[model samples]
Target: MRTTPTAHPNTELLVYGIREIVDVANKIKGLDPALELTWENIGDPVAKGWSVPQFLKEILTEEIHRADNRSFAYTHSRGNIETRKWAVTYAKQFCPSSTLDYEDILFTNGLGSGIAMLYQMVAPGKRILQPSPTYPTHASFESFCSGNAPIFYKLDPEKGWAPDIADIEAQLQNHPDIVGITVINPNNPTGTIYSQETLEAITRLAEKYNVMIISDEIYFRMVFPGHTHVHMAELAHARVPLIVLRGLSKDIPWPGGRCGWLEFHNTDLDPAFKDYCEAVKKRVLLEVCASTLPQMVIPTVYNHPQFNAWNQQYSTELQTVADSIADTLNQIPELTVNKTLGAFYLMPRFKQGSLNNRQTLPITNPQVKAYIEQAVATPNLADDKRFTYYILANTGIVCVPASDFFSPYPGFRLTTLSRNPEERKKTYERFAEATKAYLGSG
Candidate 1:
């Protein structure tokens, strides 16, 4: 039947940046499954051969039996009240000045859900201000909710991927409609840690502009030595309204838990923010509350005495990995790798004028070369993404284009999550070789 297609105005088929690029890469793929492929694209630590300690695994096992049928039952819409109280006590350890209580905490499926809830609260035509080179999930959610793309302030790559205070001030001063600012400490894709001074400046800006602060501190405890993660709630001090989102996925060393929560700060200082908090809780009820079993494990998992010990040990080793990658990639001459100070990712930026539109990586296989040629024929993909596709085909190395973080930075993010020391060194060496060869081709 040659009937006209029906219109669906209210529907959306949404895709975030990472998956979207990976899809394009897959569509143009020409390689066979002849070799093991390395995934440097996704940020799952456990997937890369990192394992939780035996003691932690036992905690889970014991909790399941001890929790009884309650663990299997649905929790309150705001999550198990007892768990909420425990999370507040835990979060308060970092921000002792915080007055947040059980009522101020709300659980979500993950930090991602918490983000979606917050974005949905943005009034029509109003939006949140995000840092450039942001994690795509947050960026896409803000875009989806506002019906308009959010504006990004600069995170200066020249300055160790630090937030540009002047740029932030200019953005706030220029755009009065920006209701809040979002920051990811131990920033993804770049792994740059924000200094206490930098954080304070941001806090002062939020307070001065009378805007809310939305912080994603998912990597709070993943910091290396000489650097510490500060809770925005610590600096905020109830002066400026704030909401800090964190999760068990990273620190609990458990990604599949699907457990994360938000802590509201200084909401009573602003009537609108207070209302927003109430709205977020009601919104979670719409989802019938995040999965219950993971909520059951939080109090037990966090309060364990040795939790901080192993975590610090892990952090120290992670610092070693970061330094190794920075030193290796920095030696490439064609690359400038940022020394990762917190998270387990490293962003090696291409030196100025290192890549051009017509540049490409070598593809010995004619079919693969043709596939990439076709994929990059138009000005559709970012230059770094084109490099990603070529690198995938040529070396079986998968990585995300760093500029995809939306900072105009020419690079890609690689992780230090590889558990084997020998394999980690070889991987970075191969990466360096590929990058140098790729840049040399231009």
Candidate 2:
């Protein structure tokens, strides 16, 4: 039975539409089971062959054996004391300038939750500036809470997706209501790690603008050998306040663990910002605590030497995978590929004029082709999303549309985390074929 809606949704809160993309793919799957579907749309390392390390699994299993009634008890709403302590030590080791105390940290189910709670703390009429092609979770929440489209400083794709300090300055100069700035290190879709120079420049901009910084360093520890991951907390001078968000989702490849934490840095430097952090904690307090078992896993892992070695090994493997995917995608002349340095994803943009409303792929599967033709014909659909649907129905490969990230461009973001190396290569190679065919540029 269906009921008519009595209340209207805040339409402003509807920008994160990746799930619709997934739904479209599933529909295509039913139309053609012969095609193998490769879901590269989102960042889920565990699904891509980056598995829980055997050593960590062993540790988790042993902990389960020792579990008691106390293990199931609710932890502190902010975080378990021991896990927050470990986070303090971890933050200090990497972020040299990070002088985080236990009280400075608060844990959430994952970085997504952390971002939500933080955004809810922002006052109405105030804004948080983010990067275009941002991780949708960050962009959407900030926008949804403020009931406005996200305001962003550009990450110019031409200059290898680096932040244009001049543009950032202009945004701050023009928008007095923007009270905070976001930095996604070793960024999500683009995979461009901000150099130390860029990090320092941004921190200075925040200080000059009197805006706090929100640095999502979820991929901090995953940068390649030559690229350095700077924790904004480390480089954010004491004058500028920041909230550093991190988690084991990428580092430990434990997305299901849903464990992430926030380190409120230099909060004392701005009493108003300190109040905001307290308010976020108060809201989280109602939920009691984040998932507890994952918190327990961390302290135990820290004691094992294999854990450290495992991280380094996993990072090196990702570097190899990222390079391979970039190399493959760049081979297609119609696409502009950026080699990701830190995270396990890369974005490829269609060269200007390569994709337009008139475009159609040579999808021989009649049902698939018909579905796509109907999809692209719909009014107001993003061209990139239409392209993504064609890619899905034609090639059984799914990549997120760039517009989903609030970008002012047409492209798609794909991951290098396919479980099998050979299959991963084949997936992109097939995509290359499908792309070349779709654009008629081969």
Candidate 3:
């Protein structure tokens, strides 16, 4: 039994990287049953007590009752015909001059898959650019598929996490290997919506470099007051090759649907790009198709009269929640909260030099304390991780560290989705208490 371990013969080249977001989420999920998990890690709305609107739910119910919808069947690998047409029409309603055809649209399990397929066609060593403090799935997928980590430009924290246009231009000028740019509007973790000027400037840069624009607009309908979600297709550039990814996951609050689509804007611009899309469609066709039930319901739910009203009321309420949480966190001098323009996340930055290795939240249980100590010993420990581990051990609160969000800062991302008013207040109060304790000890 003392023999040396044998090495595996082979593995997929793409399996080298890890998705820290989901890995950490699984660890939090496996916590002791006695603990109350606050679940501020994942961006799932239904998990936070936001229900699907009655009108949308009715469509699902009707679909279930219909005999024709029962079988699990294959669709066009490109997606259902009706859904693709509806999505095109949906885009045109916003971008009247936008040039996209049904052939350009491709459906996958979700945007996660769509991204992988898109990156697959890109030649190795050619990088896709994104911003720092990014969603791990985007950056990680690019790395996995292309065998290169993403080429990223800086998003200035002092400037409210906006992408530095000059840095972007400089990067593209210096690095001619970059073939595409990724933009996440109403970004995850930070919730900083890209300004219209920023969007246009990015488009111009993409055009200047002759690279495509990969815009992730999944939060398209989750906009709050004073901020609007602008689709890249709607930009005045009707000929800039762009791949816009979107779905019903966020707005409809139906993440389990396993349905999302990619709209290829300006596919005609590059013949090679057109061929790349065709290759992806061929790969998709091999899978029979994406989930059909969701595809079938897309036109129905989107065209319903109630969708707009529900989104307006829902976003208005979400704005209040985002504001309250930001204001509360800002009151704590130890934490700096950002303006959450659209999504339900607020990232509180821990003041520099405020945390130390020895700082901890008050913990009573010996077992939990031991676990926290082990988790905190890892390399590149940030102040946010210190605060997060302490809070988890002491208050039974589970949150994703900003380190997981790919930021150098030491702070955690807190959600504004605690639906119960009194319970929500208690959660914030406990967080503030834990933060104060950690900072005080330091």
Candidate 4:
């Protein structure tokens, strides 16, 4: 008798069960057939009414007209030599003390690809420390690579989502397998920027523990007036090896560019760390190299005078939306909105015990209500179940639950990228109303 074909399986890697913000956005996109879909769920600034500067467009157009770039060609897995040189120069401006070379820069499809490749190079079961309620890519990549959950050092919500250094040290003490620590400056989901004091303290921890430091500085240039960007390399913990990730995705507002690079700092300090980085480089060679067109545009975009003006204007307009959002949400006694320092997302926490299974948003449709009922019955009855669906069914607005962002509290996250100011205010007002109605506060 012929045996049935069996499905083959092997060990799971470090990435598992971690949901992405894009997945959430995609789900919403599928749901709304006719709605305007004020998209705050993802971090694509271009979609938020910010257009590329004219100089950048001209540069990109000129590159597109070049016949030499039309063919598929390969560069060193480390990246193009010229782009690498510029990266070194750009990084040197921030990290003046450290001498960085072109060899220090490794480019990839984007920061996401860079992160995945970097984590994959580490030995199996070796952990990379990450912040909780983090940019899910970091947590998901590490978890996917290790075939186990990535160890998370909590970013305290009460402390404005700042990294808890003491907690990190304690985790490192217990989990000796942790080989590195990662921080997202101008952090995703929560827009808090780390103070120089916090950055220095983290550097000290890395030095003490002899662990590698991986700083994702994708939002380095997105800081508003009160908040300033700080590069991890600038901290210059010489004893601690550093791998700094930066990209054009956020700063240049070019998500489609699919370009970013990692700069090695203190590579000379550890032979083992150097070897791991080499493995990542070899993998990049396997994939050829990052998109050359986007790499070519970097020098022009960063050099253009209009770049700073566009950034400043964008930040100012976003701050206004953030403030409006904060003021609107504050009217509701059941929920609390934190100060948004950077990034495009706002995380609002619902008062503890304020949300229970018994309370729910008023849904007119029986099918939607039944769907939500089944969704909440599972072991996970977090804020997403109530708030996310409530916003969907009642107000026809959708948002991700804060718990989806790995938060322990009962809360939800919303975006301030609505181009229409009046509609934006109305959305938040409706959010406040829906939240109150759900909690029976009215």
Clash count (model 4, backbone only): 11
Best candidate according to TM-score = 2
**Tens-place lDDT digits, model 3, residues 1-442:** 5988875332222331123434443454456446676766667778888888899879988987897754267777688887898888888988888767887888888888777777776777788887777777777677766665567787777877888899889889888888888888878768888888889999888877888888888888889877777778887345578888888687777889878898888877888777767777777776678888899888988889998888888888888777877777788897788878887777778788777787877656566666677778887677676677777767767777777666777777866777666777788888787778778885
Poorly placed runs, candidate 2 (over 4 Å): 1-9
Q: In model 1, which residue pairs have backbone atoms overlapping below 3 Å?
A: none
RMSD to the hidden true structure, all candidates:
2.4, 2.4, 3.3, 2.9
Q: What's the C-alpha lDDT at position 268 in model 2? A: 78
- C-alpha TM-scores of all predictions: 0.94, 0.95, 0.92, 0.91
Expressed as tens digits, the lDDT of each residue in 118-230 for candidate 2 is 99889899999999878888888888888887899999998888888999999999999999999988898788998888989999999898999998888877878777776
Error of 2 at 413 (Å): 0.4
Cα lDDT tens digits, model 1, 121-240, are 777777799898888777777877776666888888788888999989999988998889999998987899888888899999998998999999988889988887877888998788
Model 3's TM-score against the true structure: 0.92
In order of listing, the candidates' clash counts read 0, 3, 1, 11
lDDT of 4 by residue, 1-442 (tens): 9999774332343322223434533454455444344445666668777776777788888877878874146666677788889888888788888777888788889988999889878987789998888777788677777777668888887888889989999999999999899988888878889988988888898888888999988878878787788878878646689998889886667898898899888888889888987788777777767777777778778978888888888887778888888888888887777878886778888887777767777656565567556756767566555567656666666667776666666677776677678888788788788878888832
Stretches of candidate 4 off by over 4 Å are 1-36, 70-74
Q: Best candidate per lDDT, number?
A: 2
Q: lDDT, candidate 3, residue 23?
A: 49
Query: Model 3: how far is 424 from its true place, Å?
Result: 0.7
